[model samples]
Target chain A: MALINLAHGFVEVFQPFNMLMLFIGLVVGMAVSIMPGLGLVMGVVLALPFTYRMAIEPSVILLTAIYFSGTYAGCFSAILYRIPGEPMDVPMLWDGYTMARRGAPAKALGWALVAALIGGLVSSAVMVGLAGPMGDVALKFDSPDYFAAVFFGLTTVVALAGKSMVNSLISLCVGLLVATVGIDSIYGTERFAFGVPILRDGVQLVEVLVGMYGLGEILTRIGQGLHIEQPKETAQKVSTQFPTLRELIDIKVTLFRSTVLGTVLGVVPGAGATITAFIAYGIEKQYGRRRHLLGTGVPEGIVAPQIGATASVAGHMIPLLTLGLPGSGATAVILAAFLLHGVQPGPMLFESPASMLMVYTILASMFASVIGMCLLGFFWIRVVIKVLTIPQGILSAIVVMFCLVGSYANRNSMSDVWMIVIFGVLGYVFEKFKFPISPMVLGAILGPIGETAFMQSMISSNNDWTVFFKGPISGTLMAGSLLALSYPVLQQFLASRRRCAAVA
Target chain B: MTPGAATMPLRRLQAAAPYVVVLAVGIFLYIQADNFEFEQASGRIGPGAWPKIILVMMMATALWGVVSSALRAGHTAPEAVSEAEQDEALTQLPEIYPALVWIAVALTIAYLLLLPILGFFIATIVYTCVLMYLGHYRRPLRVALLSLAIALCFMFMFMRVVYVSLPPGVAPFDQLSYALMAAMGVH
Candidate 1:
């Protein structure tokens, strides 16, 4: 049954319309990725409203293509200019920039592209194999389990907070508060509608996304006087030079290690590409055969994090497809896209043959996107380099225009425009204070689902407070959330103790 | 690197802002959540129950933040305090001509306000041309031509292809949209 569904998806995804959309997404994504200041999450958010008029299949394929290529293209700038186009691309800069400085720019870029291809292929295979069985298991979950799952997903904010857990939690709480501004989901009661008739309709998620990530970003840059020191491109003549047979044999173990590590970490909700990239780099630096020569411009150093970050795309999709839990910020936006299209991507999503086929089609498109990205990056690296030359002030104006049109087009309501402005100002303020915005976005996306699941669990248990801990699955998930929430604090305490002991 | 100079009142105020804002928002939400009516009555979780619970968590978190910030301030040694202040200063955005931020905001507001009145086409063209000029792209012919071309392309894409019913403006400008749409066989 699964085979038949997947085969049907293969045919659907290969259709000319879906193929064209995929190609467009790759080109646009590559363009967006090569530009600094615009991160992968921003790229996804900017493309979201454009998909409003598209069918679900094309929309999913388009987004997947963007997601895939965006990861692939960031390494280009990191190698040629030492400017990481995306945060995940930062790890690539250590060895990639050094390799370029050592007059092997083509070799470093080639290694990154090759690693991305291997990682993406491996991750996709894992996703295709495991997602079906996982979805089947999720089908058996009750309301309490669902609630627990969302709660676990929410705790990702804490895991992602490197230094400021309190600020992240505050950002998350603000998102939850915003999510409650409209009519209450289950009770048909208004909670935060302060007598304004428009407020009763609730805040639109697209407006918030556009306002914060899009317009809000532009406003913040304008405030900074658009004073960014542009990185000078050193590679005058770009070429794609895949590693020779001897060189390929040299980094085989490093490649294999990062691919496996990235694939696994990608499945962990909240441990997105940036973390996976760093972890892969750390592992290579600590344990690889060429560990001493790790940061000194070697293939092993460049390949580790690039492959790990790219391969994790497949890992993120597994949980999103199975339990409808977004594992990363990119997946969070994709989840919002699925819900907007009236498709709830959980266990029930697989019960319908058509929906399952659609899901498979999207997964298949990711594979096609990897090949497309390899070809584009190999032949068009020079053209892609030109995207870096665009001035920030001009880009800001264009972005503002897109945000206005995108927000207005979402529902064609004037009120939505005002909402974007409000959220834009709020987003600008939060950013100035150095607050992480990802938690807030995740909180908004998962807020309604968490509330509904919690309410249903309460109703089913007849107001029994112990329902959450009574079930083994829910109990385990709740425990996981608590551990995740406290993990940072525990790490801090241990580090402090270690320091005291060392001093003594 | 004097301690007195480094630990200026502005730096302390900046450091405390996050905790202060979180506490204020939490208290406000708690007050608002208190007034939410319960149709299902007490004992049963109503519409307000989840929000109330979240608000309580937020308030507690805010309190923790405030206490933590205070403790952190009290524990800092004078020798290392300037070092900490320097790090914070490095992370904070430099105070450039800060009024440019407000000017950009005003420009955006003006563009939106003029959008429905002058239509997306005219409003966007004017907005972009002015923005480019201000941003140091001062070639008149280039700015005007580029803005017009970009604005039309945006209009055609959103209005004609995507079918967004953007305001056509009043009188002559409104007619331009219809004429363009009809010319393109979209109407």
Candidate 2:
């Protein structure tokens, strides 16, 4: 652990360019999250490919740093604009919007920043502490073990289901199916190309990722037709004070509890930060001392949700390191990034880990980016807040360009550029109707892993279906899935009955 | 927007119908393509079966999504407004078409022009300028300057260090790239 922490310090904060990237990530993350439509997932996804060219540590660090600051930046608009900048910022809306209306937008922002920064840094520390030991555990697994991890991750497709597991399942199915769209890898057979030479290479993960998240978001933003309201206050109407050390102490306990919760959830293969926030909200309502202060921009609520969300990033990496199962969208991107650079993740990754420094570089870059966020924060808010007023068309075009160049630049193929437009339309449609495009991207990312693992397990067992459940690890994971699938049903039932009783 | 409001399923249906149809068509194409396999598993496992399985999966999921939307619209609680009022009750946000449309057009144009002769670095600079304009950047000089600065920074960082081969340009700029490469310690 000492060596691990020491490695983080060894992360050469010395390079000005790498340091600049951290600052850039911090600034954009702050700005984009403040603007409507561009969520952290979008910011992270769009930014992922750019890192392919960077040294891995800096790349990962830059992306992780954005992941850190972007989530917090959403609160800025949530407080001032009565809009939740992104989905995770929704809880902040309740108290934040209230504070803004009450002429305390700045105060809400101040508290949120303090809470988010603390929450994020603490969770990152835990990640840095735990990643090495846990990653080492992954080194023991063989093909079957890899299969188990794939099995574990496949369950994550349904993680977004609010009340309908069936819809989520359908979405997951669609995503997996979409993965079959090109030349068959193993047998060299053309499956679904339909004579379009464009798709012979199969469904490109990067293209689909951008189409689904990036373009899908732009379309949704247009449909929503958002408008920014000018504030009446001439003096910026900002927060009164940053969270003082005394105030920080007051929220520290809540932060700790939330951090633990987030870390655990994040560590799980499928449960993302959204889940963490929802659960943290529930826990706060259940056990927080000032329960009445749940949504009133209370420091505890702000700190708790953030801790859970930040912890989710590092926790998500555990499965990625150990099982090669990406825990969430960013991890999915990380998986894609590794593959792009010709680094295969999973058991082989842990065995010798010839490219481990790339990942370490990402981690180093993440720490650097966080410090950069702090520095940028001093100036970013003053500038980025004005960006909110920029016309959406121009921004969308820039996004579209990135979407194209990003896809094209990956292989220097105009074919991929065209794929961007195709995916963009599909993405727009998916967004318009909320069909869960991420699942498809996730499916594409995990397709080979899932297939190879399933194939290996089958081949070893002579195509025996029963072999999928042979080991303790596999059994444990399957059992966990059954429990996860059932838990939500039971909760819904209980909640429904309580409502019935109240009505009666 | 008010929570728990139910609306006409037509909008949802209209939104989803196109995807269902496209996927359905894709399924048909996939079935036809399944027969075009390479001669006897050159590697491991015949190619046809896996792709076939994926196609069936995608079609099925899309169908499920269609059904789920229908179900959600059906089960929507009736406490707020009944089926009729829900249609008109939807709160639509304001549309800022100027920013969105121009930006999209500008991006598409830049991309089309950039792919051939101008090459990556020059193309990127031009594209970045157009983007800044689309972004409502008012000061012409600042926009141009910022665009150049951005282009230079990225060209050095991404194109040079990462060694992402910038598409070779025609004429003068092509020579410029060669010269710069020579100066930058490249063979």
- Best model number under DockQ: 1
Local distance difference test, each candidate? 0.80, 0.64
lDDT score, candidate 1: 0.80
TM-score of chain A of each: 0.96, 0.91
Local accuracy of candidate 1 as per-residue lDDT tens digits, B1-187: 8786577555656567678777787777778877777576556677877888778777787778777776676555654354323422322346465576677778878988998888877888899987776555677897888898878888788877888888878888888867766775666
* Reference-based lDDT, residue A250, model 1: 80
Q: What is the C-alpha RMSD of each candidate to the true structure, in Å?
A: 3.1, 5.7
Off by over 4 Å in 2: A1-5, A100-107, A161-167, A229-240, A244-246, A347-361, A378-380, A487-504, B1-187
State in Å the error of residue A361, model 1.
Answer: 0.3
Per-residue lDDT of candidate 1, residues A388-476 (tens digit): 87776577667777888888888898888888888888888777776777777778777888888888988878888689988998999
* Tens-digit lDDT string for candidate 2 (A418-504): 777667766765544455565666777777777667667766666666765677767776766667767766777898899799899
Interface RMSD (Å) of model 1? Answer: 3.1
Error of 1 at A53 (Å): 1.8
